[model samples]
Target: MTVTATLAGLDPTTLGDALRVAGSPGFDRWQDQIRRTGGCSDPIHLTGTTVTRDRDTGQVLHSYSTEAEPGGRLRVACGNRRASRCPSCAWTYAGDTYHLIRAGLTGDPAKGTPHTVRNHPRVFATLTAPSFGPVHNRPGRGHRPCRCGIHHPADAPELGTALDPAAYDYAGAVLWNNHAGHLWRYVTIYLPRELAKCAGITQRELRERLRISYGKVAEYQKRGAIHFHAVIRLDGPDGPDTAPPAWATRDLLTNALRTAAARAEVALPAVGDQPARVLRWGTQLDVQAIGAFGHGEDLTEQAVASYVAKYATKAAEATGTVDRRIGELSELDKLPDLPDHTRRLIRACRDLDALYPDRKLWQWAHMLGFRGHFSTKSRRYSTTLGALRQVRADYRAAQQRAALGLPDPDDHPEATTLTLAHWAYAGHGHTPGESWLAATIARDIQHNRDTAREHRAALDTAGEW
Candidate 1:
């Protein structure tokens, strides 16, 4: 009666009646969710029927009739969060990604890695895009002169600003960003080889005694360039959770990085079948020793972990991959600060999108036709995003069950089984109201993380106490 009354044309009088009957508990639950998290900018409202079967016997013994659920439909979250695309969902995803990256770095996969693997020499290394013709820069790494006489200011927005916009190689950068995954895949193969060469062992033999375990995140530079920041560690074949070989010092790892960055290269099909494009990492490569806290000037392990985690949730959209599709050359015009090279790459992505519609590239059309996962890791590189997420879910479920005071929570079976759900997108984004709630929640979350960082820092400084 209460639920039905609330649905009576959504009038204030009826709403008051429903609230009085249903009480404040249920209302608070709904309101809290509305304020804290959103599924997407505009979530896909769904209407559907679902049934779970006994995999063993293929028998359906229960069902939740739509008559029983909210308007015979469920309010499900749309899972996208790009403010430009799906702000609501993007927020959720970004946070999840940060946790995932942090979990790997801290060896706290899921419930957490109480294990000792957290202390490895895990450094966050960044590899950047090279000169695709002169761009306005601060003039030098050490303050050398550019071909132009102007010495760019330290805060100059023009740094990486193209001197000759017409001559800018946007195409090259776009293709490079697209192929970066492959380039990374190549790095996975070559960096180890470089390490092996340094150790005076064949790649295979080197593997028998030592292993390079790493987790990496890719980020987009303000200049529309893609750079990779990774947590690299050399462990005995067993990897983190185990001590590395004595030979696997940070110095040796750094040296191997230098050799690998210079030697790694791959070739992609040339534009318009003209020729082949040789691909490799950018000239700017950085490696730092990540070890015990405060031992060096490099990024700390925990800080690096948090950094990688931060980018885990970003999409090409964050760096501005709108439209996810391009109909013609003019579409590129709508984009700002995009180099001609990048524009050409966007055009190429559109072209390739047709060649492989199976890839659902148009869905990522804003990414300029690349469909590869933006961030990935080697199979053996600690816990995975999936595993970490599952653990968190399990923990959360346990907490909920505990709150309910349910006995043997994991084994509890729903006595009744029947559900019908239907929901249509009212649309996404904060309706000023929801937006205020989300922002407030986001601020709270940020503070909580800052607190955690400080706590961890205190613990590190106090060590073994």
Candidate 2:
């Protein structure tokens, strides 16, 4: 039997509903709504009315109602950063992340960052979790057989699985993730102190002479441990626009990071009869100097930005864990589909939740106990995600204004406009037919973007515009 026929046979009700929607007279309008959402897999349905009034004249300039929209509701992308949930939204999020990181490195005047930031002493650093146990891994240097006597491929599923699962410290692993943020906080605190020691100055003196600005993103390793990829910059006390002191070189920053990572430790409170465990960064710290936009042998600003952005959309799923919450202990038994390692981690999280009620381990079990933001930046690092999103909103508003032939809001400062909007959540998700069509549209958009990028790259290589 054909796939469609088989699917229809397996779920007739859903198939029939999808078919009916496809044949409906409003299908084109429905497709338009879906396209406006960038083909989000689960677009949020909102029923609302919006009235735009000129405050000066007390006249209704414009009004909109979802009553005329498809299904009497407006749909918007869920805006989930997880690609697994919504690829369309995830793509948008990754693009925003890339720009945010790139702006900090190369600078964008529009984003309030100066081009002089490119000359700041910057390094791309990777901070990792201390090993809880030995896991199957491909030893660096040359491809060698694992301790398990197996020569694992690059994509091997067994790569991160413990050689002896029974002996693995699952509790330690989960707790490490829970405390990772705290550990990073300690590192940040100690970093300046280390820098001062290196410069033969006091912490107060270091602060007066130089400042540290950083942007970091957390990534889950195959072993389900959380690690950090960061762009660390040493700027003058005034921030990125000002030049760093002569003593603030890339080597000094790298050494300070190494010392801080080594010294930074967080000791957990002793629970029950268990002794307090001290958490610190793993021995495998990699600090690489970041080069200027188009020079030097080290990592380029664009490469570092792209690399950090790539991890911003990911979670524990990269390590075989599920991308959702575990509501109950019975849920563990039903998750036979999960890998043995992942299942054990979930079980450990659930089990530990009772012992450490304050930790709320079960709440973040899906994340393997991590609760930190995927991407974070210091205040002076660069523009914010909110600022980037505002830029997009402003552009869209401008387009709408031009299309409607409305006077520029900025041009009329004396007149104010009041917007009243009320929206109620209706529902989400699409009919199977809608899903199929939306997916096709998303693919086409991505393809066009990729093609345009390729063309641009080709033109650049050929030294043409």
Candidate 3:
């Protein structure tokens, strides 16, 4: 129990290294940060090379190498797939996502506005998955009839369930999810034609008069259905299109969407006894104007931006599924306590893996049967995660310089200064004491978010900025 007793048989250099990493001033804050990070839980620690050029001459004057950090270990914040994984990093990601989406809609990088975007008609839309076979679901008010003619209990386990499991169309639901992106693309493409027709304009000429701009995200409903929520905007040529037709109302956009969803369907390759598959949006597609005045369930630019950003960090595992990068097929049957539906999804992805051997679905076997990008957007929609990461990198680098008392804008390209670094993944995760700290750090972040939400709620109530 005594210090000497614990160190009695330890190697001197190894013990000294331990003491330094654990107790040195340089590592105290870092250790605290690591403890806060909870082993980064899902940190994306990266090691890479940066090549910078002279602003005027465009000559490659400087290259900062991290190839030598311990084990070549470079302690970059792990970009997480879930907020639950790392709040500090996720929060930063979420904030960056917000601004990225916001800038696309509002067009102001600093204040997240285009000044002209507000003049456009924008709506937040949510389209949910069709019933696979109802599991439990949130209660509804003033409920509609269940075509089955039986009133299901508000908390009843029968909601969203297909009356017959054998005929429940699970294949369609899964495939719908798999091809949902394609269906969405079809809609995006079709909308222009429909809008043009409705507006008495040619498809090619549609852009001359108006444009459709949107940002959307997919979410899972409890019964294993993938639904989408979107922010749809009607803009002009330069985005948030300047000239609006008298017909460019929220009602018009909603009408165009409804019509498209009804008719939009894509034929995917067939499987099992199932006939050729035709993928489509769920039977229930809700498009409402986003506003507080009950104008249209106003998906305000800010609210929609934030809402979509929140879902950006989630992975399939959050829904009791896996991330799908399985080491082997045999591993699928051994995923501990996974639910049947999730297990089925994983198998499906494994099967689909044969179709796109390059994507390696079997490799990502934990992600169920789907192997597609989780969140993506059109280039014009906004900034990117990479861009956001760069901003933070620049900020942190500046801070590092400030700490060393380097000159402001340390833009020097001098390569006279030699560099040496080396690091290995000293094995991920924390000692018990560090785990304790990581939890504390996460709690602090959640608390801050809650407090900020409360402040915003108060502001909304008072109608003040």
Candidate 4:
């Protein structure tokens, strides 16, 4: 079979190389490696050797070397959760995020959460950054002309652009992003205080009666500002498994959130000639009560989980900014593809770096001055991403042991083993032929997963599980 003829629309040069790779003797092994990665677009290459030994008997149990593998190196997924960087990894990340958020709300025995958590008071809250300057926006409620004298569409490129870039508070915009994490921290601290006050009890008494659990993700707005979407829940002192006091209701949680948000403020010290600035959340606060399971509402458990997970893998790219670190000032000039608004934000970050070196504005200029993790959760909210990844690793190890006819790790009461490994980073990414093949495999795998999910949903609708 002529592989080149089968693959239409590919350039002749790329087709020839792909055909040669397809006919190579190591093609099967190479394909297996790519499949193992779920067809990651940019996999990391490593040169290494690993030896497993029985610690008690001082016997070599297993030995492996990348030199023996195809291309004389091992390839591993980069595991970046950014969708633009690697879709394969991003999909996995979104799935894990969905599971983590869902487990907290709906409970999952496998994840060590109780089903009774569904009874906890929960709300979906959105905290936004205060305006640094007026920008074009589509006002909700009755279509009206924007301040720019034009009714901008939801997808308009000019929607978030400043009406007057020169007069806009660019420094304040960047600084707000830098301090967003601190603001959120203060909000969390004040939340319990407000709840206690509402209950006419002290902080210590409130803690003894109830606890606050939350999972939040930061998202970039089109104007290059960061906002947060969080699922906030009220649990008993011991956590989700225990029922909250009768006084804790969704209305109480909403009132407490509003009070905390209004009271939470971060004061920034004067930088250079700039005066001390006080930053707080925008007035457009949204706090909605999440309905119980099977209830029809926008704030249902599944809808909230899906919404948070959808943004977990996104970043400044959604706001016309690059999703990478900016190293030098001159680098920005070389890229004409960036929008003017994004360029101005990046320039502001760079210009302020000298004045506020401690903030590391230049280092995170690509992110528009935000350096915090996109997704974060309070301890005891649910299982963690690290724990989920460890579970996957353990499952894979068990599969490998079974394939090799070895005893299960749990079967041996007093057995112990030591693993000796040394690895060096060789490089990253793939050759042109490899890149095409890996992308195809990734698409197919994602398609299959989607199909399976749809089929399961259909079965669930028909009461088939």
The 10-residue segment with the lowest total lDDT in model 3: 415-424
TM-score for every candidate vs. truth? 0.71, 0.94, 0.74, 0.95
User: Candidate 3 versus the native: TM-score?
Assistant: 0.74
lDDT of 2 by residue, 132-153 (tens): 8999998872278888888888
lDDT of 4 by residue, 209-251 (tens): 9999999999999899999999998999998878899999889
Ranking by lDDT: 4, 2, 3, 1
Error of 3 at 314 (Å): 2.0
lDDT digits (tens) for residues 125-222 of candidate 3 = 78765555544343454264565666566655455455555555555566666666667777887877878777777887888777787777777665
lDDT of each: 0.59, 0.86, 0.62, 0.88
Q: Which candidate is the best by lDDT?
A: 4
Error of 1 at 416 (Å): 13
Off by over 4 Å in 1: 1-29, 35-73, 81-106, 109-115, 118-121, 140-159, 269-273, 294-296, 316-323, 327-345, 348-365, 368-370, 402-405, 409-465
Give every collision pair in model 2. none
Q: Output the better candidate (1/2) by lDDT.
A: 2
